[model samples]
Target: MTQLIDPFARAISYLRVSVTDRCDFRCTYCMSENMTFLPKADLLSLEELDRLCTTFIRMGVQKLRITGGEPLVRKGILTFFEAMSRHLGTGALKELTLTTNGSQLTKFAEPLAALGIKRINVSLDTLDPAKFAQITRWGRLPQVLDGIAAAKAAGLRVKINAVALKGFNEDELFSLTDWCAANDHDLTFIEVMPMGDDMGSATRLDQYWPLKDLRARLAERFALTDLTEQTGGPARYVRLAETGQKIGFITPLTHNFCESCNRVRLTCTGELYMCLGQEDMADLRAPLRANPEDAGLEQAIRAAIARKPKGHDFDYSRQKVAGKIGGQMTRHMSHTGG
Candidate 1:
């Protein structure tokens, strides 16, 4: 068994693969209302994706997370999930999960749970129907709520990921928390990162709400006990005394979780991004398409891992005003399959 160890000595055991860049909702912070998506021909075929993922698993990748603009929106995505379930059965892959918007969970929840996905992270910023529409642009609140119900009924552990927007979702913090607690779902709050140009730099700046502030506010209501639990992701966990629910904070800006970073992202087009905040990427599609034996593909991946950076440069303190963008990536969050 081969293991991928970066120059920084962090073993790369987690892989986030984007199945599609196309999303149904044009979230205000994720992308522009009118977005230009990658052509279908440019994306790696399902068979190619399965091969690439299997190659990584062979090299000791333990956890695989399927992401997209919205993974369920992709046509025939269940077949891919069904195929990956075999790795789980063999115990070679420790876990196979996905991050979704919860809109399509109503239709796919049962099948996903049957395919061996024990848990999933659903992106839900607001419980208010109007605010939900305002944030997600093209989303329907009732539809997502129903989908969540279906997912819960299917026995999938649901984790709600809410982006802490400055003025947008601030009022709903307690509401979101209470809802998650009542529903027996875990909740995680994420600070907005300066990623992509689809949402203007000014909007990113305006949307940037430090998790530090959000945590302080949360502390006012609930007694939070810090817990040193690592979920193989970049989130620091704390348990609330009142609800006994675990809340996670992904503070890329306020607190850097880079020193222990052990994951890499692969776009739908087969581009491997070693770091989310860094633009450097390795193109694995050429090798995968050129050689059927996967020798070239394996070499390309090892080389890419060797060049992984120690940390990402995502800082929001440089600019006090909204006009200037600071330390922001040029690619959209959806492009990298947030």
Candidate 2:
């Protein structure tokens, strides 16, 4: 049996594939309001994505995650889900999940659940309707609320990812946990990391709120216990000491757990990024267009993994410098399959 293992001996079994570089919301942390989206022609076709998944599955990838600027908005996504549902039934894929903004989730939840997609991660920062609109620029909180409920009704395990920005929504930590506990969903607090070509946002780095301090602050109200049950993602889980509500922390800046990194990201443009925090990437599009054969694409994947950086090189401890786009944090989280 074949397995994806980097030189560091980490077995890579998960793959995140971005289907589009377009989003409906102008998330303050994800992209600017004046964002220019990638041309429709640049995106990989549904067939190309399906082919890539087949090759990775053959290589022993156990899990597949569908991500995008907003995956559901991408055309022909339902068709892709239909294809993956077939794989799920046959056990060709061990697990299938998605990370979405929950914009169109209400409409797709039942169909997705029927397809055997058991889990989903939704990006939601604030529970306050006004704050939600403020953070997302023009997001309607009611829509997301309804979508989340629809997902729950469809029996899909839901996880929430909230970026712990200092001034933004830091105070809502406990409130978010309370909501998660009530909903029986897991919540992950991710430290805001510098990503993308927009090095111009100086105060964005100031929003970086380390998990340690966050825990210390939140612990005053809630006790947390370490949880080790696998959900097939990088975040470390800790159940709220009292409510048994799970809370995860993805701290790439303060403390990066890169040694256990076991995943690769494929952008919508068909580039395989070996490390999320690093710029080490392979142009799968050029090779796929030229060769389109399984063996050729498989070789391309293996070659890219061969040179996958040992770990990401991000330094957030230093003073926040304006307009400095260096290190592995050069790509936008939207394009990087976050």
Candidate 3:
């Protein structure tokens, strides 16, 4: 028997692939209205995506997540899901999931559920229709809400991915929590990430919705409780006081969870990014485009694994430079499939 090697101290068992760098909505923290993405010719072919998924499965990947500039925006998306489902049928992947803006879920939910899409995480920041429209710009709040309802009806485990943006929607956090409880839905409140080309001068740790404030508000209304260690990664679960509602918090900026990070990202441009905040990447697209043998492909993946960073340190005090902001950041959350 051959002994398996774990190069990055952190055990990477999950892969998040960004199928495209293009999205329908221009999120404030993701892209500007004038932002231009890589040309269509730069994206990986569906065949290339399939080969990468197969190789990762062979290398002990257990969970695969399909993300996008809105993954559903890609043409022939259902066919792509079918291909991934077929490859995952080998029992190598324990779960196949997706993260979407929910704009297209109403039309694609049933077929996706049938294709073994285990769960879905929808990005919805506000519950108010008008406010939601303002945040997503081109998104129709009513349509997204309908899509969420449809996904739940299709028996897909549904979760909301809301970013806690200060001055924008942080005031609605508790209200959103209550709404999720009433709707029997799970909610994850994520901290805003500063990775876009236009973070400008407004992106700072001080602007984040402090966990202390969030926790205080929740504690007043709910009995916030921590989940057992075996339940998986740290989200810090809690139950609403009046209705036993469940809510989660992902405080990556203020309270870094890098030590327990268990995933890697594959970009649509064929680059393997070990950390969302890191600049290092390994290009597997070149080797795979060359139609290399299985061994050659495996070697390329292993090399990518070897480059994974130990962890991301967002704490400016702990960051290498002090008091000074560095040059422009490289990738956006959409490209990294956050």
Candidate 4:
């Protein structure tokens, strides 16, 4: 098997693919309320996505994560999941998982679990109904809670991914931690990243709450034991001694976790983003659509992987210099399968 190794000698073993760019909710920090979505015609069909994914798997990708604006919102997405499960059965894929907003899990949990998806990440910022509604403009807290319940009932291990917004969720640190412990779910706190356009960037900068601060706050309330576990993602883990529940911190801004990066993101339109904080990308759709065989597609993927940067340029310290956010990508996080 051919292995994908970048200039930094990091093996690319994980791939996050976005099946669709359309999402049901217009998250404030992610995209605008009246966001412009890509046309369906521009998106690669399910079969095309499958082929692209298979190519990556053949090139030594073991972990496959399906992402989207909300991956479950895409029509006929289960079929894609079903198709990817064959790799798990054959032992070619180590895991098949997804990151969702937890809105559609009630409908997809069973099907996904049957397809060999053992765990998933849910993007939930707050437990307060009013605050949840305010953060996700179109989201209903009750519905998402119901969906999360359904996922748990369906035997899927759910991990809650909360963005550490400065003023938005500061008060919920203990509340959220206690809730996750009570529900028997792992929780991860992420720093708000500087991506997207002016409006979104402005909001992200204002919302930026460094994970260092959040961790310090958590340490005050709970005894956190540092963990050395890695799950093929950026989040570093810690275990709460009191509740015995695991907590993860993804500090992209405060700390750069790019040295051991082993993944690449594929957009719905078949664009491969080597680094999320940089604007550089490679278009694989043209080569993919031009031929049915895997030779050209494999070559294109390798070429893109070869150009992968050592680390993303996501820096918030530049704001101290001239009141400017540095290393901000022009595309929205949703567009890059966040």
Candidate 5:
């Protein structure tokens, strides 16, 4: 079997497949509430998704994560999950997981766990109801809490993914850590990345509280130690040196993890992105539509990998390039299926 190693010697094993580029919630950092989404016809069907997943597995992608604008909102998504879980269970893939906003997990959590999805990441930035509503625009804090409960009741390993938005939840850092510890859920604090109009020029850069400083703060409260757990994604895991509570920091802006980046993103419209921050990509829809065969599909995927960028262009400090402020992604996070 031939291996898939990029020019940087990073063996690609993880694939983040966005089933749709539409979400119900409009997070301030992700996109605008009045965002336009792709039409249904532009999305990749389950059949196409199957072929793509198989091709990726053949190329040594052992970890496959299903993403979406919000995957659960899509009709017949469970049926698709069932089919894909069965197929991947028999394939070379090591595990299948998902990342969601936990908005629609109430009815799907137990079913998801039954279908072999044990690990789940739920995006919940703050514990404050008023602030949650403000950040999500119209998101209900109770429904999301219920979703988290459902996920835990279904025997799923739930990791709370919180974005450290400036002026939003930075003050709750210590409290959030305690809350996660008390609830028996692992906590991963992610830095806020620029997506929608840079979330206002006055507040954009200020919102990014680096994980390096977060670690220093945690050290003062609890003994912090590096974790040796194998994570499916690029989160730097740490354990509380005192009680061994698990914590993670995904600092894409401050501490870029591009060198150890072994993953690629595929949008619902069949655009394969080599990196999330950059615009380096190939149109898989063209090849898949023209000839959805093994020969054609594999050739296109291999070509994209060959041309994958060595690293992303993410600068936390926001640099000036020819009088233009840079570092934010050219594409929206919602469209990228994050």
Candidate 6:
């Protein structure tokens, strides 16, 4: 039987699953000082995750990324990976990746890599251990670094994701570039997303780390070169002066690339978010289980895909980053797998 596709003609090939909405670290930009997390029962169970992943695979979703406040923090994560890997072979998943803060990576890296998990991106804002503490209130930088080392030791493709907040970690750009070059790690500088505001964790524009200035400064130290479009995900790539070090920049604010966006996020509660910045989501747990028929379930998935917006418009000119939407503390990044 022929399958139905989304309005964009994209078969929703990628899926980012949020395992839970709970986190140990309280990063100033992602979580609130007093965050109220969801109950454990609300999160998708191991069986649920496996079932949903299989269903998504059947619908042409080939790549899967596990996200969370920190996916490693989720109990039975290694086992979950084992089950999913068994059900969905490594080749079946073009890329089965995970986004984490790397706090608990040391413990899970080897096991996860053994489970056929190939690539990993760890969120690290600063290299200085002290500043790392300040950025992630309760996190230990050593542990995170160890996690990175473990992933590398396990023979997995490792990448470091640093959210460049203007005044916060912007000063460390040079250090970060040098670090990535020295350690042979792909470092990506991400602009703080406006989605943080919806969760009541917005930062001012002044805090935004602009790529224009960063690129200029790096030019003095290294001869930067651009990469081809086929290189993959949004981050525009560049090489170091003499060495073969690769660095990337995710400049969503300065240069929004939503037109070529091919991402779909699955919230921890089983709601599918087609667009990162938009508020349109469709619940699949109920409909999928209510009617087990393939066509019936496929129709529901298509309906959600049809609702996907073309792009997101986050006003950068607004002074008050958290203007009217101040109750975003409700769902943590762990909940939506950001």
User: TM-score of each candidate?
Assistant: 0.97, 0.96, 0.92, 0.97, 0.95, 0.91
TM-score, cand. 3 vs. native? 0.92
Clashing residue pairs, backbone N/CA/C < 3 A, model 2: 196-331, 223-241, 277-328
Q: For each candidate in turn, give its C-alpha RMSD to the true structure in angstroms.
A: 1.4, 1.6, 2.7, 1.6, 1.8, 2.7
Off by over 4 Å in 5: 319-323
Report the CA-based lDDT of candidate 1 relative to the real structure. 0.92
Predicted candidate 4 versus true structure: per-residue lDDT over 1-338, tens digit per residue: 66999999999999999988889998887887899999999999999999999999999999999999999988999999999999999999999999999999889999899889999999999999999999999999999999999999999999999988888999999999999999999999988887767533445567788888889999998898999989889999999999999999998887889999999999999999998878889999999999888799889999999999999888776643234456766688899898
Select the stronger candidate by TM-score from 4 and 6. Answer: 4
**Winner by lDDT:** 1
Residue 154 local lDDT, model 4: 93
State the lDDT of candidate 5 residue by residue for 1-338, as single tens digits: 57778888888999999998788888888878887888899899977887787788888899889988788887888877887787557868778888899999999999999988888999999989999998998799999999999999999998999988767887888888988888789999888776655543666666777778877888888988887776757688988977668999898877668888899999888899988878788988888878746778788888898887877777756643334667667577877776
For residues 196-266, could you state the per-residue lDDT of candidate 2 as single tens digits? 65533567766778888998887888877888776666688887779978789888877768877889999
In model 6, how large is the Cα lDDT of residue 89? 64
Off by over 4 Å in 3: 1-5, 203-207, 229-234, 316-328
RMSD after Cα superposition, model 1: 1.4
What does candidate 6 score in Cα RMSD to the true structure?
A: 2.7
Which residue ranges in model 4 land beyond 4 Å of their true spot? Answer: 199-203, 320-325
Model 1 lDDT tens row, 153-238: 99999999999999888999999999999999999999888776643455557778888899999999999999998999999999
Residue 87 C-alpha lDDT in model 4:
98
- Model 1 residue 311 lDDT score: 93
Clash count, candidate 5? 1
Error of 4 at 110 (Å): 0.8
Quote the positional error of residue 148 for candidate 3 in Å.
0.5
Candidate structures ordered by lDDT, highest first = 1, 4, 2, 5, 3, 6
